[model samples]
Target: MIICGTNAGSPRCWMLVNDTVLTDVQGNGQIASASDISPPYPSQKSISLPSDGSLYSAMSSVTGHPGSIRRTFGSQKLLKTENVWLLNPQFAGAAIMPSTLKYKEEIYFFFSELNKTARVDEEPYRARIGRICTVDEGGIKALLADSWTTFMKARVMCGAGNTQQQYNNMKQAVVLTAQDKRAGVLYGLFSNAWGRTVICAYSIEDIDQAFSTSKLKGYSSPFVGSRPGMCVRKNSTTGGHNDIKNLGVIRYHPEIEDVIRPVGVAPLDLPTDDQITHAVADIVLAVNDEHYSVLYLGT
Candidate 1:
């Protein structure tokens, strides 16, 4: 089965029943009807299907319209992001990362948002990496009732810290994870406003660590229970309410204070200037019983 977005950016499920014919998963004998999905002006979109069979989508936000991330078509409850979570975002990519626990798995969304309040010297575009737990079932009725409670995002820095060479626009991203899912790397394609493009690599473990420990933006008080944005087992009787309490905390503060910087604190010094348009990365097993990373760039 294959899942994709229609020209209008609605999600559709397709299956190849034979060599000469393709049909919807339901075998309706016609192109899958998109009447059930509704996301506005989603010409440019990012979609991901996790192990849970849910489809996650993020749409491009045009002028005066809000972009959104939503989950559907799974046994679990449907979830969507709050309108205030994303600010004029242009989606770049999406991927699912495994976890030690089933419910701790995560779906990551990559994008760059317009900084409407940037100063004359500051860049107007900022790259971001947002993620949510695969088992997230939304929040409490009094809080983000139908919204994600484990949503948390961190700023992605692709250049040297606070330097002029920083590339603020994230054009693409791909992840390569280990067999245990404990170690991984995120390869991101970033471009500056002037169109200079560069590649940065970040350790997935580092990112996970930051989100697990960083303080919420504009929030400093001690947490009442487990930290916000954590993946708690919903069946645990002792801390089931932890997820609900977490919802209220992140509903008001989803952005983390710690910024996610690339490994080695800089972008890769690749000897190429051929106008890289996209990047894909993979792990190859070597004869030495070790794995090596290979990155492919498109011009």
Candidate 2:
């Protein structure tokens, strides 16, 4: 099956089942209900399909509506809709990278978000890493139905060394595997607000720790968002805990906040010429043998 979009060229992703009539594995009904399977808006097209169903990545809109990692079933029936981190439409946060990767049963999306920095004018954009599980069909039926319970994001600070002076924005993300065909590493292309491009790398372990560890605590806010961050779980009506303080709190074990802080940031190095440029056009990981692999990045 090929990955395709509802429109001609946009990255709104869907599984194109190359059956007799072209079916939509992600519920868009390849033959009869193309419109039903089409994405909700114009956004990124990071897509990955597991053995049975498909999951597509998208950037949340700035209109106060957070984007979701969604799975549809046969035209209007949505199986799950879990909120994703980053791609905030308000601050112009987005994951407009070249690819969305699904490797070793996990999904990865890299993008840039406008930071809430003290000096916002100097370093407005910060690159980030977001991830979710492959089989995740959202949260439990009661707490959250049909949405991811394990979705989270972290800031990806490349070469900053806890220095706040550096500014970075993620431009591209790609997944690489070994000749043995297992998820190996992730490479990201980033640029600063002042315009210097840098490439960084992350192992699966790096990503796993950032998410598996207990969430960090520093400051709190009323609008900090619920833990699991589900849209449909707006109120706790089933339990009859009609307390106003609930405020639709969907209890979650956060990984990194919307952005990964400087101290927790650790970016591995990958060899690259590294120059100031508009963007990295594309990237590829080719396996030389079971023991080695080569990363090809073109800016």
lDDT of 1: 0.78
RMSD of each: 3.8, 7.8
Can you tell me which runs of candidate 1 are displaced by over 4 Å?
Answer: 2-43, 63-65, 235-245, 287-289
RMSD of 1: 3.8
Model 2 lDDT tens row, 205-273: 455555554343332544342433222222223444432122233233333543343322544344655
Error at 284, model 1, angstroms: 1.9
- Number of the top-ranking candidate, with TM-score as the measure: 1
Model 1 TM-score?
0.86
Over 4 Å off in model 2, which ranges? 6-51, 60-66, 73-104, 140-142, 165-167, 178-183, 216-290
Model 2: per-residue Cα lDDT at residue 238: 41
TM-score of each: 0.86, 0.59
